[model samples]
Target: MKDVYLFSGFLGSGKTSMLTDVIRQLKEKNLKPAVIMNELGKLPFDSQAVEKDIPLKEMLEGCICCSGAEKTEAQIQSLLLDSDFDVLIIETTGAAHPVEALDAVYSPLFADKLNVKGIVTVADSKLWLHRETLTPQVRSLFMEQIRHAHLLLANKTDLLTEVEQGQVVYELQGLNPHAFILQTTNGRVPLHLLEGLKATTQADKADIVKAPIASLQLGSRLVEFTDVEFSQEQFEDWVRTLPETIYRMKGYVPIEGIKNPMLFQYAYGMVQWLPEYIKMPAKLVIIGENVGSLPVIGMN
Candidate 1:
């Protein structure tokens, strides 16, 4: 069984930082690892953050849920056959849902090429408390990222007080009490945490209720707002109007103060934004559970 490690986290939660550091440490010990960085946008930062000694590739412009994960299998199969490295590290897009991402790797196509080393989720301790205010699709994305992980690297601990760190971990524990949680800054996770993991989640085929990306009841992304351009104020209106059932919201938006475009999500009435350090074309995907209504916008 080959070892495959996934780096999962919310947008700007330091997935790249952690990945880069991990690769560096592995190489320092003369361990070679292959990488697959998935993304919805053209530019993938994780691949570049890594040092040149490591072999890496970027899978962009799609989600793991691609028409039932067929594309994901194709990509992974290609990587497995082409790379000579001992381990595969998959860095999922911020838009990715970890369970769904796991499903992609566990597909029958590469079943022999991979065995989950462990799933590591990066949690931004500073922003978690305000996550609810992000868009529904965004919140669900974060919650889902943390849901099925066997090990979680609770990054950004420096931003919180000792007591507050406990609060964040407690809340995350509420989400996935079984997972081993580690605290760190800039996603400095120990390599041992990724050594062993097995995910038994049955492949999610349910249309609405068990969907991986949306809230169980909120019907997020049902209001699919993909590739649409919304200004800061317009984005704010959508935030104000989001329904409670919408657990996550995400995608790119053109914000006034941001130059390289920006990504934002709403969860628990908290709006979390990650400034794009590099300019990328704008795109968005919103998921809401059971709402069934496409977003209808009105200019004020």
Candidate 2:
């Protein structure tokens, strides 16, 4: 039977980074891994992180647990029939509920063919510290994700002070006494910690009630910048002017005087720019609450 692992986390919690690391480790061990990525936006930005050689299925424009559940089952069925992979990794949207995601994956048709591992959740330490600032619904969803995690990663610890880090660890431990919590930077975790794991048993799962789908309706907008090169300084200024409702933004941006587009990522008021050697499409996906009302570019 193939091993199946599910990744659960909020927006900009570094799920893709952790997924990439997991894929690399599995490949090094001579294991073939297939990926199923769900995105809230129309564009499949995160899917690009998976290599072409790896079998991949993408469910776009909805949460895998809700509207995409049927599509997800179909995709999984297709991958199982056509792919030669030994392990399956499913990464759900940031707004997805852990219980619902698991429900979609536990299809009776293929459940016996897989050995279900567990949910690996990445929690941003800084976000945990300021979670109260978020709307009650979003905060509840975030906590639910952490509460259901079998292995929780306190990610982005590098941005937290020692006291804050300790507080995050304490809070997470209190919320999930059964989980193995690890403090990490950039979602880095040793692969050995993830192996031979089992999902929450039937009795343990009985305790988790499904979250209200109505409360988790985060929005996303895909902005394409074709043949347009932005001034780096101007872009950063524009990002600063964005409202706090915008939680995560990521994609490639073409900068003036740069030969290739730079990978841009913004999360929780922090922006990171990494030089990309390859010429990726110049598009950005902004995810947040009512993000469609936000301007694609703040500067004229």
The candidate that wins on lDDT is 2
lDDT of 2 by residue, 1-300 (tens): 878888999999999999999999999999999999999999999999999999999998999978887798799899999999999999999999886786667543455466667788999899999999999999999999998787899999999889999999999999888688999998988888889454321111112222221212243445656657888898999999888867666677889999987888776788999998877767665655445345566212
Candidate 1 C-alpha lDDT tens digits along 224-287:
2233456777778777887775544445566655666686655457888778787654533343
RMSD in angstroms between candidate 2 and the native structure over all alpha carbons:
17.3
Cα error, residue 79 of model 2, in Å, equals 0.9
In terms of lDDT, model 2 sits at 0.79
Candidate 1 achieves a global lDDT of 0.66
The TM-score measured for candidate 1 stands at 0.63
Q: What is the C-alpha lDDT of each candidate?
A: 0.66, 0.79
User: Candidate 1: lDDT of 29?
Assistant: 68
Q: What TM-score would every model get versus the actual structure?
A: 0.63, 0.67
Candidate 1: Cα lDDT at 224: 22
lDDT, model 2, position 179: 81
